[model samples]
Target: MAFADELKKLIGKGKQAAAQNSDKIEQAVDKAADFADKKTGGKYAQQIDKVQDAAKKAIPDK
Candidate 1:
């Protein structure tokens, strides 16, 4: 398969997996965001939260 086609297939599989386990994905996003906030000493909590929200929203609903 061509590189682009392979990438597209991989992305599709990823989306399917995300939809199957959206709750877990959101939890991981939250944990990562919290870790980032803590590492930054909460200096960017607002920005981190915005990103966290966006990430959670991006997960496709089943």
Candidate 2:
């Protein structure tokens, strides 16, 4: 799968997992962003940041 697709899948899984665990969503997003940043060699930092921000906003508070 493409990087973006893979990232989306990871985020979806994280969201579901976070719904159950409640405390790991931020860490999951951070790890996803780190992976995306490293995979893209930081070339898409802005996009990754956007994704991270959106994830944070979407995740419900515990």
Candidate 3:
């Protein structure tokens, strides 16, 4: 198979897994965001939160 097609299949599998465990993904993202906020002394709390929200949204809701 072509590299692009292989990559697409991999991505689709990942999306399926993410949808199956969205709650876990969200928890991990929240934990990572909290860690980043603390590491930056909360200076980037708003930006971190925005990124966290985006990451959570990236997971399929299916």
Candidate 4:
């Protein structure tokens, strides 16, 4: 019933959702990375790749 409890519950729900939607989330990360690559003309390809890896890593396992 407290605010901290609500916040923790929300965080848990978010992680659960992330796990359930892992595939979709990965696709989104890839799409976003591709878009950035295109806009930058692949100049920041390495950094983009690193970010993509990091994003994927941030997703919790199902």
Find the candidate with the highest lDDT and give its number: 4
- Cα lDDT tens digits, model 1, 1-62, are 69999999999999999999999999999999999999999999999999999999999999
The residue pairs in collision within model 1 are none
Better of 3 and 4 by lDDT: 4
Per-residue error at 11 for model 4, in Å? 0.3
Give the Cα lDDT of each candidate.
0.96, 0.86, 0.93, 0.97
Q: What would the per-residue lDDT of candidate 3 be over residues 1-62, giving only the tens digit for each residue? A: 69999999999999899999998888999999999999999999999999998998888987
For model 2, give the 10-residue run with minimal summed lDDT: 15-24
Off by over 4 Å in 4: none
RMSD each, Å: 1.9, 9.7, 1.6, 1.1
As a whole number from 0 to 100, the lDDT of residue 39 in candidate 4 is 100
lDDT of 2: 0.86
Candidate 2 lDDT at 27 equals: 88
Error of model 3, residue 32, in angstroms: 0.3
Q: Write the per-residue lDDT of candidate 2 for residues 1-62, one digit (tens) a residue.
A: 69999999999887677777655778889999999999999999999999999988887664
Clashes of each: 0, 0, 0, 0
**Could you arrange the candidates by lDDT from highest to lowest?**
4, 1, 3, 2
Put down candidate 4 lDDT per residue, 1-62, tens digits, no spaces.
69999999999999999999999999999999999999999999999999999999999888
Model 4 is weakest, by summed lDDT over 10 consecutive residues, at: 53-62
Q: Is candidate 2 or candidate 4 better by lDDT?
A: 4
